[model samples]
Target chain A: MIVARTGNEAMAEAMRQVNPDVVAAYPITPATEIVQIFSSFVHDGLVDTKFVAVESEHSAMSACIGAAAAGARVMTGTASQGLALMHEMLFIAAALRLPIVLCVVNRSLSAPINIHCDHSDTLASRDSGWIQIYTENSQEAYDSVIQAVKISERALLPVMVTIDGFIISHGMERIDILDDREVREYLGEPPKRPNLLDIDKPITMGPLDLQDYFFEHKRSEIEGMNTSLPHIEAVAREYKERFGRYYPVIDTYRIDDAEVAVMAMGSAAGTAKVVVDRMREKGKKVGLIRMRVVRPFPKNYLKELIQGFAAVGIMDRSDTLSTLGGHLYVETRAVLYRASHQPPIKNYIYGLGGRDISLEEIEEIFEEVLEIGKSGKVTEPVVYKGVRE
Target chain B: MPSLKELIKKQDLLSGGHRACAGCGATIIVRQVLLAAQYPVVVGASTGCLEVVTTIFPYTAWKVPFIHSAFENVAATIAGVETGYRALKEKGKIKEEIRFIAFGGDGGTYDIGLQALSGAIERGHRMLYICYNNQAYMNTGIQRSSATPYCAHTTTSPAGKVIPGKPQFRKDLTEIVIAHDIPYAAQASLAYWNDLTKKVQKALEVDGPSFINVLSVCPLGWGVPSDMTVEIARLAVETCFWPLYEYENGKYIINRKPREKKPIEEFLKKQNRFRHIFRHPDRDKIIARIQKEIDRRWERLLKRAG
Candidate 1:
């Protein structure tokens, strides 16, 4: 049954449904409620799971890796510097194919050291071999976590479900949560892979791969990721069938017959969607495309989706290789490289380091997209609605 | 009387054919520890010489369920694993008896990993953490670590005209672990396999967190011949440089003692890292001071064990 709950409660309920055997976590702001509510379940005997109170974020991820390697369903939550501290093990977890599911309360990486919402933390760990999914709100946070576990176990790759810190992690909202039995039947039992700890059939995992075999091993990881596309869609379909909530890997809001589309992710997409709705009411042919799965690229899907658009304004909270380019712009261009009907893409680097990306700012970005479509070559990178120097 | 052999499991959890360097004391210690553990044991290994050598992608040497976490989180990882096992057992999901053990190098345990180790012990988790004290970071090309003995040459702390080996003395990780007042803490070496095995078995039998500091000799790091690894470790104990002892419930017990104490130079002469000390007579005073410090610590341990 659907119950109105906050993101943290939705996450906790989803974890209860997944029934992870071990939950090792340390409390951090924004991510604490996820663990706090889960701990209550452990205390009340609502869930038969071990709740480890680790000393630091490093230990939290380490403990999860250990439990996961030992053939137990393991989950943990962290943010910002905590995610950075767990960076090394994240790669190990993926390489080991442990199927660990991590809920990342997305926080800004340090420098000015803000603890609020941003995509930089998860963005920095893009190449860590984890299948990353960005959630726009509490409902997505809960729903995506269940989907993440199914995808990770099926692909034999770890998954990270990211919700913007404070914006979605701390923001209270009504979210639908499926019953434990329904979730159990939907996700089924975690697929039995060759675990590191199985005594009867002993298998060695995480072996040293020198230059000779390292390439092949890396290629296999890529193969596993490539294989995840169908499995992720299948899991999402299963979730929708069981719980009556639909979520696509890439959710397009009013993009059909549109001249301009704002591409973004996380809670910023919510604001962008509102701006798109307002622009549509004013007789403007603009829409929003929210990227759900950031990793495994979804290049082919994006190429198909952006085929008929006149101009695509890619809004990113992260910078890419080029000074003026954003990560979204780079991926979008790479996906649309040989397409016949590729749109003229404009890069907009905004909402970095937890700075507010309000609805007004999204409107301003939409205005830039309109101006750029008319001019053809308006400006390089066009830092839209940026904080004035 | 229970036979010491009966205390060990017949199954070889950490098998052979791994890519550890020849005469690797750390590899031997891991095997010994695994043999001493009961069935359904979970192992948490830190990133070190043994971990890097054994777990290379899709090829593991470990027969038991093992995890290789970051350098600083082995103890904490094991503690969490133990907690999971406890919860599972209480819920009747896990019916078999299980033990949790963590392994780390001196660089990981004595320095970078100390905080996590401290937290695990303080939390009183049922696990055993063994620090294979190989003196330096052998995995990372023989860099200087806090466990490197004073007057010993390393890649980072090389003996030169201006500087003669590492200036700081080795950190006493055994004493530091013991100070936490855990039920069990000990120091062992590769030279005494039976004693090391017995200590591991005893640590596993304990209900709370136990720490073992093993003087694992690294031939390549110390610039000694691979064949002399065992002899080098033996001389270390005979010279009283690494005392073999155990602390149980506030009581100190020396497990082994040399019948005839050897001179520090005998141990120093085997390793090329310390060869410079003997060549220069001006460094005699430094060697003498190190010898004196070893002697003092040994006397203190003996008195406490009494």
Candidate 2:
């Protein structure tokens, strides 16, 4: 069915079709409407979902851990401070190996309390052991929520589906939503595991381990992440065949033989895609790559995606507060080191606190990358896009 | 409800092979609560000694489905499980009746876990949250908690040169939970098995959220001899220091009131934690103040009960 809906509404729409056993969440800006709308759906009997309106996001994720541990397909949504509040439980959700789907409407973390779009919130929790998937538009946002359930459940790890808070969550767009029956059949029954609540075969979850087993458990978690990559690819393939929506680890646009390429994640990628087309029309060899599955950190796909580029401009919506650049920039550089070919990569930090990055700014970034391509050297590996200094 | 003897015989859900401390009142409370539950239960424990000692990988004593989540949020975790059970039952998935119970230490319930507990109760999930109050954070080695009583000596509230013990009185967490206006809330003690078991059964039977603050004993944390766990806890109830009461449907009922209340000194002197107050320069003054405060609180509770 085709409908005009905001990203939050579309996520709620997908949730209705997936029909999880329970969803626990606390209301927070930008992401609040997702659960609020889902609660209304429960009230209207649109879905048989148990909506747990928890007082805080910490409880929200904690509840998801319990529900998911009981072998129920569980989900929740949060943004910014909500995600931060859930930080401790996020690791527990992963370590307990429960497949709870978390929708993160990416927003800036607070000091003075900003509610705008930034990758800081999710990036800060990147090591929480959740499979992080970024979406560029409402359609991908909707699709990710559905596929994330399968991925997380299959991998026995929690999944975080993120989109820019104000940019995508509140912005309305026309997209094709799956038929409820199709979605139901596609998801089918949630796979059963030995549950914490199962009376017949009781199992213990999240026990303390000091020296004997902590290392082994962590190594096993690393194995869990390694095992999820193929599952992600397989699910994406099945989704493409069923819904005609294609999502690879990285979405490459006109990068086949480009001399200069720009990298973006989430909504900024769409804005950069427009600039990519404009630069190509002007006879400039500039392309764009939108990274989708960041948690598994598809370094090889990224290395392969930027294959023919001489100079690449990596646009980071959030700064990592580290020595040189953002998290994506550092990881991208490190990954490309083993790629058999190293491109001169320049990092561009932009769109912080919902700061708008116009097409002209993106065009200028491509021009910079082109200049770097000519020189074959990146004098400034990191540049603040719109900052005064 | 099962008779005390019958309940004792019912397969011990918390098995014997686990490693709870000797004369651990919290573990006994867990066992009794499980005995009274009518439905098959899934137990959740906060990150504490009970959780750490019981399910230390490859040697879990929990015969029933048990889970240990983060230290705080045990209530939230069980609330979520209860929510899932409702959905599953509605979908014709769960046929048997299942109950959810969460256990937490004093620190887990009264301090960091407070918000999550409040949220879960306010949201009205059908589950029983049992706070095994041992006065302080016994899990992390007896640091003073909000549930730690006044003038109690803990690691954080050491009775040293300038101070007595924990300076302030313990926060009334039972009243705090009652403030949410949940379906049922109560205070019980491990020593009062009949009263505690009855309250646990009623809590499990409640259709909405229920909370029980079980004033449990801790040999290590409370600095009492292991054999004195029961004696100390019984004296606590007899002295009105930890009253046995219940609140249901907006009405309060004092379940067990001592015919003649005993002196608070009996309860205080049994524990080494309170050993210092007896030798302090102002010993008489402090002991009288403690007795007077207990008397005042007991009278206030009686007025409410009346």
Candidate 3:
């Protein structure tokens, strides 16, 4: 049914439909309402999930890992520092191959300590062997979470579904939610894996590995990610076939015949789309590419997408502070490296700590990229967009 | 409760031939607790001597379903496992009854993991959290932990020329756990197998979260011979330095009160960690202070247990 819901509301509704076996989470801003609403569902007996009101985010992720390893469908939500607190357990979860779903409301990391929307939290955890899916709006957030359960289970790797804090988490938008029975039918029964709860065939998990087998075990985990691309695509395809909304790893708009393109992720992609349409009406050959998945880097599809464009502007909500630009910018550049025709890509670090990214700034960015496309050269590679001197 | 003969007949959950140091009290404590559990149990261990030694890769001493998460969150991890079992059983997925237990060293339990333990118990998970209190961090080279007794020498809190051994008193973790008002909380010693096993059985039988602090003795960390682990542990109880007690349903029960408490020097002089206390210039005053503290605590415990 079509209903107006914020991103957090959409995620909570999806979690309710998923009706996981256990949810252990601590409260954090923007992401707190997702677990808060789900806990009420558990309280009202809408779902038979055992909601663990853990003391801290560290325990929240630890419990989720324990629950998932015990062979239960598990879900939790956190943001910024909460995700940062869960950093150590995140690697353990991925290394152990527990299919736990974490809903992250993207927020900036500390120092100045702002709870506003930024990609620093999830971006910093990029190498932690998780399947990261960034959503553009409330609808995408709802769809991606439901899809993440299937992907994580199939890949045997944990999945992180992120929405921009406050922008999507608090802002209400019209979204279509699937029926509860339909979601259950789509998800089907939980897989029977070798779990800690098994009595007759008892198994040991998360044991210490020394030099003898640690490298080989890590290599196998890398192989799990290496071979997960098809599983990710297959889940997205089946979800589209059943639910009628398709979300690919790399989604594009008006990029069929464009001289210049702007790449973005998360909620700002929605703003970029409007700017793209306005620029197109003004007869400027410009388009937009929104990256949905970041973890299993989507190198091949990204290379194919950025093939013909003379120049591209990459928008990053979080800076690496390494002077090498933001996470997306650095990774995208690495992915495009060694290509026969290298596009002069400019990195636009914008909207950090939830500073607004307006249409005017994006239009200016497109104009600069369009100029770069014309000259086939780049003067400045990395620009801290919209920041005061 | 099973007799000693019956318990011995039960399958050994923790297999032998692991990498633990000889006479490691934590391993013995684990064997005793697992033997006492009547139901099929899923065990979790925080990063510590028990975890690293028992479950080295390519070889795991654990015969039961086991998990070793990070250092400070085993209580939370097992709480999750218990919650998972409940959820699954409610869904008619798991039919059999399975108990959950978590093991942590003194460092994992009293210091870094204390918050997680408190939270798990307060949330009322039906699991048993056993802390193998070896007084210090035994796995990472004898560092001082909050559970280290007063004036005990550790690598971090050495008996240097300036300041003696560990200056602070050990944290009474069992009392702290009792304040959570859990269904069962107890202090047991590795030397007393019967009392330790009985407490484990009682803890596993409780309907809500239970905690047992087992006073584990580390031969390496305590600077004692491998064969002296249990004897040193027994001296700790006899000297009234570490009492055997239990708190259940708002009642404190002193299980083993020494008939005539031994002098603190007997317990202190056996280990090299406390040897510095003997040769120090203020040795008499230091010994008196230790005895005074032990007497004061023992009297308070007797008053409560009465």
Candidate 4:
């Protein structure tokens, strides 16, 4: 059975189904509702889970590490500065291989601080060894979270499920939630003895790797992450079989015969989808390809998907240090260079710090991609869209 | 005295074969704390010497459930873990007895991690926070920390002809923890394992936040011979430099009192970091004044413990 619910409710419902042993969290803007709803479930006795009220975001992730270490399926939520505060532990969680699932309501990092939708927060932690996934709508956000648990546990890697702050996180939208029985059946029995907690068979975790062993240890983490791709797809397939909801690592919208395809992720992809629909109706060949899994990046699949296209426009909400290059554009270019067939790619930096990204802006992005394709030339690394200055 | 065999031999929570430097004081304290703790204990460690030596990807020294968080969140993390355990116990999901403990270095507990520690104490979480006070940021190559004693030479606070070592006295973290009026707080040293063990047991028995400031000597950072780690720690207390005491329910108790206080030079001469103090007579007076401060604090503690 499917119920129409908001993003927060969908997340809470998914968590209730999983029945995480521990939920450690401190309230932050946009991400607070996820914890608030879960707290209510704890209060109402709907879910049997430990709800830890931490003092700050740092403590939230810290407590999560302890709980996850103790072989508990631990879940936590944060955004923006909160995510930044947990930066140190993010690396620890990955290194420890605790399979902690974090819900990140993507928000702008501070300085000239703004608490709204953007990829800056998660992007800052791009190299923190977490499998990062971005969702475009309430449904994807809900489904990705459950799928994340399966992928993380199976692969023994932590997963971060990101939804745009105040956009998908706060926006009320109709979402299909899998029934409790279906969710349980799909996820399967929680591991009776997590690798860290098997008392009979004592296994040491998170040991000090000296300079001689550090590279090999890091390489193993990479190998573990690389192994997660197939596991993610397999879990997604099982999810579809159990609940009739298809979740693709990369979702393409009307990109079959298109010359110019605009690529984006998170809620901005929703606007691009609408724009693509309108463009197709008007007899234009413009399309959209939304990236879901951003880490252990689906490079090979992305290369195949973009092979036939003449021009690809990469839209990003986060900046990479130096040269005004955005993170997505850098990864996309790298993937295209390694692919058998390549395409002309133009980078667009937009919708930063929760600035409104409208369908009209996406249409404009589509037009710009076409212009770049015709010219067969690109100027600066980053082209500002819907901005003054 | 309880025979070592009679004491409950805990399954090595922090197993051996880890890559801590030979005679690393922080690792010793961590191992001792884990052994002193009851079974089903959750450990939250801050990013410092103990954490660095124990946790590297795919090769943790810890056999128990161990967590290494940020430099400043150990107290908060343990508090949260305690909260989670309490919640689980109340819900009947968890039936086993468990305790929560946090380990941190001087830099983590006394400096960067102070706010989080204060918050955790104020919230009244049932946990013990042990600050392994090594006096400097030993993990990051001996930079001066707020807990560094006066006239102690660190990489950042070098004793040149003009400057004369770390001029400021070490921050009184135990007194600050005591001011919070938590259930229990104490100061211990790696030199006195029995006293430290007793303090840990007492703190575990307390219901609310318990703070333990352990004076852990860093041989590498302190410029002392590796084998002399325990000896230097002993001289620190004997010279009335690092007094051992406990504060319980607003009452003070001096755990280890030195009957005949030794000269401060005996402790200073063993460490090369304090070599400059002996070379310069004016700096010697500064070290002497610091030792006097320690003596004064010990006298006050004795009065309170009465």
DockQ of each: 0.53, 0.80, 0.89, 0.37
**Model number with the top TM-score:** 3
lDDT per residue (tens digit) for residues A105-223 in model 4: 88898867788777989999999999999988888888889998998889888999988877777788877676788777777755654443333454544555678888887899889
Kindly report which residue stretches of model 2 are placed more than 4 angstroms away from their true locations once superposed. A29-31
Model 2: fraction of the reference interface contacts it also forms = 0.81
A-chain TM-score per prediction? 0.95, 0.98, 0.99, 0.95
All candidates: interface RMSD: 2.5, 1.0, 0.6, 3.5
Which segments of model 4 are wrong by more than 4 Å? A1-6, A28-31, A192-200, A371-381, B4-102, B119-127, B219-235, B257-272, B281-288
Candidate 3 or 1, higher TM-score: 3
| Candidate 3 or 1, higher DockQ | 3
In model 1, which regions exceed 4 Å deviation? A1-4, A28-31, B1-22, B38-42, B52-65, B80-84, B87-93, B257-261
lDDT of 1 by residue, B1-306 (tens): 225576453767777888888999998888777766655676778888888888876678887777666778888767766776675567665667878788899989998899889988988889899999999999999989999999899999999888889989988889988889999999999888888888888898898899999999888999888898899998988899988899998999887788988989889988899988987767679778988988988998989888
| Residues A1-389 of candidate 2: C-alpha lDDT, one tens digit per residue | 88999999988888888889999998865455888888999999888788888888988998898888887889989999999999999888888888989888988888758899999999999998899999999999999899998898789889999988888999999989998888899899988887865688887777777688899999999889888899899999999999999899888889876887888899989998898888888888778888889999997778777756888889998888887688789889889888877888999999888889999999999998899989998787888898777
Q: When superposed on Cα atoms, how far off is each prediction in RMSD?
A: 2.7, 1.4, 0.9, 3.6
Instruction: Return the lDDT, model 3, position A12.
Output: 96
How big is the positional error of residue A358 in model 2, measured in Å on the Cα after superposition?
1.1
Clash number for candidate 3? 0
lDDT of 3 by residue, A120-207 (tens): 9999899899999999999999999999999999999999999999999999999999999999999998788899888898889999
Candidate 2 C-alpha lDDT tens digits along B49-86: 88988988767888888888788889888888888778
User: What does the lDDT read for residue A217 in candidate 3?
Assistant: 99
